[model samples]
Target: MNEKQIEGLLEQHGIKLTANRILIAKVMSTLDYPISMKELETMLLTMDKSSIFRTLSLFKSHHLVHQMEDGNDIVRYELCHSHSEEEDEDIHVHFYCEHCHRTFCLNEISVPQVNLPVGYRQTAVNYMIKGICPDCSHR
Candidate 1:
């Protein structure tokens, strides 16, 4: 996505637009897979690690991004496809490639709803499957 589109997305999520935030969001938008903080830092050479972490933290708080753990226990971030600030519509299963150590969003597969016990509440769900990805399998 372009810078303007990124700005619009941040605004939609009620996040204040900054050059660093827009740059981070822009990089995230260009990638199809979820990225870790270290990977993002490598891509965003102009920004410091702390600044990126802060931006990601802000993004997570606003629900503009989904923070998830890959099978290897590394945290990854992906843009939330939902348009509403109060509701997240893009919840889905994730795939972790053990071969390449990459995280992918399985958008076609939906997360199954679970029945919680009495007095229990559900806020989020993370379902990750680990295996060799298509590219690795083809090798």
Candidate 2:
């Protein structure tokens, strides 16, 4: 997405269009898969790590992004596709390639719903599948 579209998205989500936030959002918009903090740091070398982390935290809290653990001990973040700021419609599965050590967002497959026991509450869910990805399988 272009900077203008990115800015509009942020504005729609009620987020301030700061330079750092815009840069991060732009990068996230261009990437097809989730990205880890280390990867983002490598990509945005000029930005401070703490600033990036703070921006990510803010984005997640505002439902502008969603985070997931890929069973690799590192958390990755992806832009949320929800229409409203308070709602998150990006409840989908993630695929982790054991061979290449890369995590992918399986947006087409929705996360299955689960029934809870009495008085039980569900806040969040993470569904990850680990295996060889297409690239690894082809190799």
Candidate 3:
């Protein structure tokens, strides 16, 4: 996405527009998969790790981004596709490629619905498929 579109998304999510945040969001918009904090830090070398972490935290709080643990024990973040303010309908399946160690967001494949007990409530859901991705399978 363009910088202006990224800015609009941040604004829509009630996040303050800052240079570092914009830069990070722009980079995130260009990515096709969830990224770890370490990877983001490497890509954005000019920004300090703490600042990036803080920005990510802020984004998470605002529902602009979602975090997931990619089987390797690394926390990764991806932009939220469902911008709903009330319910998190963006909960979708993720594919973790064991060979490349990459986490991909299967946006089209949504998480299945579950019927909880009378007193139970669901806040979030994570459904992941672990296998060799197309690239790895081809190789």
Candidate 4:
């Protein structure tokens, strides 16, 4: 995405646009799947780890990004595709390929809704499936 697009997205999510935040958001916009902190750090060598984490935290609070734990217990972050600022439309099942150690977003596969008991609340849901990817299986 271009700087203008990124700026508009951030503004839509009620997040302040800064150089670091814009850079982070731009990098994330180009990714096809969720990314862990380590991988993001590797890609963003110019920025420090804490800065990235801080920006991610802000993004999550503003519903600009989705944060979830993968099969390996590593936290991954992805841009939220929901157009509405009040709702998150990007929630879906994620697949962790054992062979490739990569996480894939199954956008077509909807996450099963959960029925909570009385007085129970659900803030977030993470459904991760672990298996070999198509490439690994083909090989």
Worst 10 residues of 3 by lDDT: 81-90
State the displacement of the C-alpha of residue 47, model 1, in Å, after optimal TM-score superposition: 0.7
| Ranking of predictions according to lDDT | 4, 2, 1, 3
Candidate 2 residue 34 Cα shift, in angstroms, is: 0.5
For each candidate, give its TM-score against the true structure.
0.94, 0.94, 0.92, 0.94
**Which stretches of model 4 miss by more than 4 angstroms?**
none
State the weakest 10-residue window (summed lDDT) of model 1.
80-89
Report lDDT (Cα) of residue 47, candidate 3. 98
43 Cα displacement, candidate 1 (Å): 0.7
lDDT of 3: 0.88
Q: What are the lDDT figures for the candidates, one per model?
A: 0.90, 0.91, 0.88, 0.91
With candidate 3 superimposed using the best TM-score fit, by how many Å does residue 22's alpha carbon deviate from the native?
A: 0.7
- Over 4 Å off, model 2: none
Better of 2 and 3 by lDDT: 2
Distance from true position, residue 44, model 3, in Å?
Answer: 0.7
lDDT of model 1 at residue 23?
90
